[model samples]
Target: MTAAVFGHDGPWTEEEYLALGETQQRVELFDGSLHVTPAPTPRHQRISRKLGNVLEAAAEAVRLELLEAVNVRLRPGRVPIPDLVITEQVDLDELIIEADAVRLVCEIISPSNAATDKVLKMHYYAAAGIEWYLLVEQETLTMHLYQRQGAHYVERSVTKAGAALELTEPVRATIRPEELLG
Candidate 1:
């Protein structure tokens, strides 16, 4: 919490990271280091909001829950704030949400951070036992849905701007990728 360099070497803990308080920038923990990401762009936020809305109705019908841009604590040194997290309902009084409760995690890829969203976070989510992960590309309005298979994730579907994606894994829903843009 006290002023210190973020992304420091070796042995960082979640308690120390959480004490930093509310910050304008988004921060995530991986491999005992902190990774700071700037707040999402307006377009990014819009896409995230739209996706959450569509997923919300589907989740409601099934009695599941959806949360946007929430912190998911996988372990002591591995908390990642995903763009949109879909999970079973939990007590609002809890301070942290565990990874096991998360059924799906979605990331709307920013141009500058595509690798992290597409590659790194995919690995993290699968390793954490999340059954579904969605990657939305901003420029093309393409959404890639992955389903966890064994210890890895396999691409289940890819929907472009005009197409509707039908998902049956983490939840059952039909989503048009372009709808996320406007």
Candidate 2:
């Protein structure tokens, strides 16, 4: 069973952390523990920002919205601040806080979260019914797209800079990995 997050306006219910707001740390709550991550290196930010920019441009062209650095509150007591998260926030005005409304969640992995992104968090997002989860590695400029199936996720594509990502459900648009990695 999942526990409700106790105390404060931040993210988690089991514990407390203000490093993301106090310092430059890009932290998250993984299974109720405070995972303090280092400030994103230039390469990390480059990839994240590039991807956000690309999605933002596409959203504008399509008259939708793509968000970045949004703290998502998943029910299993996990609150992750993803690098480039895409949810249509135009008419919604604010995050629903407790639903599977987010269309996609993308993470540009740092050294600390390579396995966490690919393995652990996969179950978290999949269980929450998030439609898609994408993983990006800045060092090699690779993209891994996972779409949720019945109860698990099947890897849709493991792409490189030359490949294009196709968004199928909420929108059908193709974006080159190079444009997202910069």
Q: Estimate the TM-score of every prediction.
A: 0.93, 0.78
Output the TM-score of candidate 1: 0.93
Q: Residues 1-182, candidate 1, lDDT per residue (tens digit)? A: 32654445566678767777667888787877888888999999999899999898888888888987777987767988999888899776665789989999999999988999988999988988899989999889899999999778999889997789998756789999878877
User: What lDDT does model 2 reach?
Assistant: 0.69
- Give the best candidate by lDDT: 1
Worst 10 residues of 2 by lDDT: 1-10
Each candidate: what lDDT? 0.85, 0.69
**Model 1 residue 152 lDDT score:** 88
Clashing pairs in 2: 5-13, 6-13
Off by over 4 Å in 2: 1-23, 61-63, 90-99
